[model samples]
Target: MIREIQSQHILQALELGEIESGQGLNQEHGLGRPGDTRWGSHYKTVSNVTALYATIVKVLEKIGSNKIYKDDRVKAITVMSTFESFEFVFMIHLMSEIFGITDKLCQALQKGDQDIVNAMTYVKLTKEGLQQMRDHGWEDFLHLVVCFCVKHDVEVPTMDDMYVPRGRSRRFFAKVSNLHRFRVEMFISVIDLQLQELNSRFDEENTELLICVSCLNPINSFAAFDMQKLLRLAELYPKEFPTNDMTMTALRHELQFYINDVRQDARFGDLKGIHELSMMLVETNKHTTYNLVYLLIRLALILPVATASVERVFSSMTYVKNKLRNSMGDQLLNDNLVTFLERDLFSRVSDDDVLERFQSMKTRRMLL
Candidate 1:
């Protein structure tokens, strides 16, 4: 059914543009293909399935009842048995709600301009929201599941009724109420595990590090720069910034003076990142004045940028050097990769400027 819907949508899109094909509706909002590295894609697939549940159910019913195709009828019956139940619907909604919170965090972190401080905040908020859902959203979610089951003509199990074990070796298993089995054990436990994983990964140390690193941002007239946070950032590296009382006190004073001097200068006012700040300081020959502070800033800047840029380079390489270009020479490949990676910077260069630089690279026989 999903394949049919997607194929029909694609054909319509090819015949008419997406908007016109769906009569101004979301024509391209068909099924999604989820992959291992893409949590957002999985979430989108689940959401689209939920959105098209009625159509899916109708298709499944038609296939299950069709005596003409025995294989299809059997497969459709199995699918209906699995997906057309209250438990499945409940799980679908539950997972969608949970993934919705995480989806935002996933997107925010992927952005190049993403702020560490904001990302930490998002993590905190997601954890809190998951906790709230576990505590307060139980009854409401159950009510929603019940309503959906009623609408679809599926049996809504009595919450207070005893649930029996469905196995061959049912040797007098202890009884559990449906309410406790589904609501407490399944629902609450699932949410608790997710919350635990998030909390463990995004602990206090990580949060503090993000907040400290964010202090170096020089945007809006260096508004994010905090002397205390900068000191904390320095403290994170004891080998670089000594923890001895005398050395720490003098380092604090140096940091204060450095920030004050930079804030007063008009040239530093427009700087956006640690990279730009470092470059400007080098241009003015002031890196030696605040050597320790400069070293810290350089470390903070390079690690994150280098890691992200390297990943991007490798990702783009697959597209740039496919199987067809397997025999591409290393030097030419390197040059092309550099140009592609630095396209933003290259875009600002004029054709004449590029020609001049290329001509100046060597004593060419003739100039263009």
Candidate 2:
């Protein structure tokens, strides 16, 4: 197994792979022994993932602007699909957290130039691409779904002070954790942004046009184009059409009214799946949290996904909250959690300290 006690960049890369993180550099004694988890992250991981997705449309517009990469369809598609992974997705705005790097990375994706598009497309729509999208989509969707469960629900920011990040988070967390719009766009944005970017970058002259065409089919389906098609068809040829929404008959004057109208029709079928997803908050009575906090709850809802992650956290927490619980204040608690959240930071401690501390714990606890 690759040890986090090595380098940070490698660990970050592993973060892209499967490296589970603990509390970051903030924690004390270390992690994984006793108590590690608290109420849980307000935005967790997916909050940020969804935030990036929300902003991705802007990125695609930029990508589509450049003529050079615009002709390189594969590169555009690959760049679009590669972000399916949380790692890549997060990195698009990773620099936004850091002061110096934030401006650069955000600009890189936003610039939508040929070179950046090429780099983004290095890993195109392969098995990896689909998996990446699913990984991000599940997290994004589930995160918003659970946002309503936060202890104190938050609202999407209006003023935009959040858009300006202090040195701490680069304003990334603020956006993702907000639980507005039912997070439906998060799913659609990830797929749509990539598709537009890919289409713009695609070289009509070269590359397999069929794959590109097929990719659009999924995008259209996702956008509910079938309903759109029917609407346009009805408009062009009204007499033959049964109703405005779904196909109609004389008995059902409403015909497809449910599918077309938002208010008059029951279920607000016009919103379709999105309406059901939004109502989940009302159903669960979980309207407290938003953003990353929301994402954590969704992950917690699943047993398998949370277990390994929880074990990793407990292992690190054992190093800290030992006999010192009474002494540890909120500041200390926050610090340890940060370190626990990002285990790569723990490598700074000496090997002797790590082992000696573990041995002492065994001695004090009377455990073998």
Candidate 3:
């Protein structure tokens, strides 16, 4: 119904010269459903709702008045009432802004060739953006919400007026103004919570590990290589580098020679990431010469990609084990999951090859 209303509205606007021919809507412009794994979807959902607010309201009104089912009418009326409120409008706008800040980081993390360095950079930018919003964005954001309410015919409560709880008596509860509730409790508090969550998730240890790992990035002719951070990264892995002063000194010396040789070699100049660097090191037979540095690079590549692969495996389980295969045994389920998850590799195997393998698994009754 929302899509139908949006289509009609767009067509009417185009016909009346209010919009251009090139301004037609696409799938992305329509309302989006939020997904658990995709943070960008949440941003799109809130943005589309705000953009099509009037159209959504119209749809709800039609359902409430003309629907034959009592439950449908009740649901539509309830949703319409909630949508036509100043509080809801404020929240939608607030979330839209917050999600917009983190959308880039979300996308960076989701990419197949994930760049930990760039991802960490984006995380920093997101935190900074949220902090700036919390500190200086209140007055402007509130004004925007107020203008939206006034334009939509929703009642805009006076900020200085005393806020009264819907079901509580003023005598029993503490008195607070609308400004305190919305600005302090809602806006500032929400941004603070988001910042806190980011800090907690990407704490000092994790951030330092990623930053040190990024020192191995081969982009820009090894511009990100920092001897101290790379040494610190090696120190984090005590078993690999050992606890003695001699091992640390040897690693530092190897790092110096490794960076020099790679920076001067033209073959390593165009490498994009640490993975490619690892491959190139082996190809050039340099891994044996600087085995310690190679070991460090291997360690750096393990965590992020391995973690993403594990997550992908878990996510694939849902598709591989559906209701029809609910009673599948452990071994059968594991085999099926392997076949499904590694379908790209399996795609190269011919049907004849699979048949031959299956035939070879056990003796058949007739071999004619």
Candidate 4:
């Protein structure tokens, strides 16, 4: 039985059926169901093809000299990606229940509904999103570093000349062809490029991560940046900020730039936290200079920098080994180790209780 669909119903159904596919409409209504009604395949006619070509050309032409997008690539992505960002947004803006009908969308969007306009908001990438973008954006940087190391031009680590273990270190990383690559600093180059392209978005959190990554490079890199992220932050968000915000921004600027640049730019002065903490390193401390400083900086950026804190958490190796090494079989030793390591379980017991258990073991046999 042929069920008749009203002209309005067919328009609405077809409109709802329009699919983006980054292609033209009427190509086929593949996205949504069209209620099994067959129409004269007007969607496939020569006229539809010509209309699509015309529609695309018109949009491309209309892109420039427009206020909303500003015809900028980033802005274009921001605007289109915002609209392309969601279906409800597109449907509300277009008002015709259409999917990929560009003319209808443009027309509906021109007379955009107040409620739809109220709901449709711009979407900027969050800090996490920006970091994910950087992880992807800097693949070229890793390739460049790989190339530089390949040519035996890895950046010098120390001020005084010291021979690099060429066999061990050079073989570890890749190489580059150009002698100019000798001057190239991998970490700073990536940082500078990121600052140049997207400096406007650098919040203190992002800048702090930048500082931590800069420290990871073996090279002694002090960047000559045209734009300090701190300066950008000061420009965008002036006046008082929380303690972490100021500290993070200062850390990045100091780490990235040369001594002169840092001294000149650090209006608040060198981060005294590092200096103050170093004073606590007494002669009795077993950790080396490198080890001590590593602990301090790692502690500062614990949340953003890494999972290094979780690594230092073995509380049971000494207790388990001493308690069970002689008396227990290997399987029992494993069980004892796990029990000792579960600090929360041990925590529930008193210190006196542990001493009593050890004393009983001592009475039975020599303590393991």
Candidate 5:
């Protein structure tokens, strides 16, 4: 009987395989524990499986050979049967490739320094990547899968063969070859669906409004700024400006004043982001001077930043308020979330500052 401690032998095999595979300094890269909260983690999991395929198979084969541990043997056999298949290999590679595109967009969107222009660019690039994959990716992908199977001594099924649907009890099975089904139904159809969904979700829904707001962005020396767009942005806030010919004329002149003043202003010259631009306006006491334009930039900046912030809050909430702590009170949970979510901000805060705030919260029985 293989001792429980002998599982280290399997881990050793994985380590050797990682070195052999030239995984660089990350030779310690083991099976990835994909996260439920992080959607991009699925790509990492699939990639790790692909990289450690041979090692995993070797470990599973050894475990399956163990007679005394029947449960371990059965599990090994089940895993081997499931994993060592043409469809499994194909799906792994396919999903990994597709996820590579999505993972980039996901990371970019989650960044604290994310720019709307940059995010929009990423969205466009992701769509194009999916489209390119749909059009020309099948041949290269098939070659990769075939090569992996050959290297691992896994049986490569004949693509042209008639694909018999498993289980005789099934009714109305579609007549299709493995090649056609894999290429058309699985690959092309899935990519098409992804592309369609991306377009629907990130399409030109608020593109015009976004473009108008982007003019106020302090990025790249405000290269994309358009006076026309800025005027359009001001026209958007009807509540701030009355809808009369006299008010409209005055508003246009005020916008012209803002553009000229900001362009020549040294304080505005060094601004980096929307947040900085908003804060600088207040620091230099210019917010009230151009109250309507300030309001516009504030609105534009808040929507995207706030959306990203809320998403981060929810992501943290998943970890802070999981099923184990399901009975936690709302106020307690909120306080915990605030600290956890704002840890980056808190890290820069001095210990003395924290102690002072703690002392101010309430007079303690003893010194805090």
Candidate 6:
């Protein structure tokens, strides 16, 4: 049905000279099946539905009226009625907008070399955008929805009228205006739920920890350095900081000198990330001089990178230990996973080198 529509539209455009003879429309208008684990897929699915709304409606209408299987015909008619409603159109646009706001953050988090500081910044910006949309965007958003409904021939409810439950008894439900029903119940409620989920995932303690970790970033001549935040960060790790006054004071003193020396030294002036800064410190033997500060830097590097690495490991395990190899022993499984996950390093080893190492490890009766 989509292809038929595309062909007709292309022919019409060609006749009208709106498009060149060799030009063609995009072929990605088909609906997508969203996955449970990735919200980015959901965004793509919703965006496709929005773009192909008219095509979908035409197909459904034709399917409903045509001589088709009874079950499919009945389902098409039911869906067509639902799709033509104001509520459905409104919800579709609303979810499309919400998912559009979050798609960038989702893509960033999926990257292997994602900058933690920049990722956190994206989270902050996403939250602020959602909040701003909730506060001042209802009128404009509703106007856009109204325009879409008008164009698509979907019914637009009168906001000033009292809203009634669609399938329930009027006597059983409380009175509310359509404005409240949409703006408060649907729009605000969905945005609040998203905000709540984000907040729960990145709560105060975790966000503060990431922010403190960003302070150790050596970019722009150690511009993000914050002694107080770093001290608080060290305190979070009680096992390392020891929960003693002396340890805290020594950390504070070390941080003072550490920042001063690193900032003034030309060797450390053009450093990039926390990892390079760590290597430079160790190479220059400053790790021993500012042992406490180096410990904090190590902690900062370990937390976020360790988490991403663990997630990668678990993801890689699915490919290494499949159903056919489900009964593989722990040691062999670990060996296989190490080679698979570190394939870039393993790729440098030759087949002869592996055979030589294997032969040297054990005496074999059959030689290659």
lDDT: worst 10-residue window of model 6: 21-30
Task: Mark the regions of model 4 whose C-alpha exceeds 4 Å error after superposition.
Answer: 1-218, 224-227, 230-258, 261-305, 312-368
* Clashes per candidate, residues 3 or more apart or on different chains: 0, 53, 0, 8, 0, 0
TM-score of each: 0.78, 0.18, 0.88, 0.17, 0.83, 0.82
Please report, as a residue range, the 10-residue window in candidate 1 with the lowest summed lDDT. Answer: 165-174
Question: After best superposition, candidate 6 residue 161: deviation in angstroms?
Answer: 4.0
* Candidate 4 lDDT by residue in tens digits, 205-314: 65554444333222122232223533343333233323466654654454344334334533314333332223333332412433423343344334332232233223
Per-residue lDDT value at 367 in model 5:
75
Which residue pairs show backbone clashes in model 1? none
Clashes of 2: 53
- Encode model 5's per-residue lDDT on 1-368: one tens digit a residue: 12232355456766788433333643434565887757678888898788777768877888899787677998998899978988888889899999998888888877877766777778889999999999988899899989998988877878999776533432565878889978998999989999998888776855566667777887666666777777777677778756778877776777788878888888788788878989988998999998877877777875674556777778888899999999999999999998898898888999999899999998789877
Error of 3 at 150 (Å): 2.1
Query: In model 4, what is the error at residue 4, expressed in angstroms?
Result: 76
Superposed on all Cα atoms, the candidates' RMSDs to the truth, in angstroms, are 5.8, 27.1, 2.9, 29.3, 4.4, 3.6
Tens digits of per-residue lDDT for model 3, 1-368: 77788889888977898877654444426775788766788898899898899888998899899857667999998898889978889999999999988899888878867777888899999999999999999888888888888878888888899887543578975688988988888999999999999999899899999899989999999999999999999989998889799998999999999999999999999998888999999999999999999999989878765555777878888998889889889899899999989899999999989988888989999642
Q: Which digits, one per residue and each the tens of the lDDT, describe model 1 over residues 268-300?
A: 989867778889889887788988778778868
On a 0 to 100 scale, what is the lDDT of residue 254 in model 5? Answer: 73
Residue 117, candidate 6: Cα error in Å is: 3.5
lDDT of 5 at 230: 75
Clashing pairs in 4: 147-175, 147-176, 149-174, 149-175, 150-174, 150-175, 151-175, 151-176
Clashing pairs for predicted structure model 6, backbone only: none
Candidate 3 lDDT for residue 311 = 76
Error of 1 at 186 (Å): 2.2
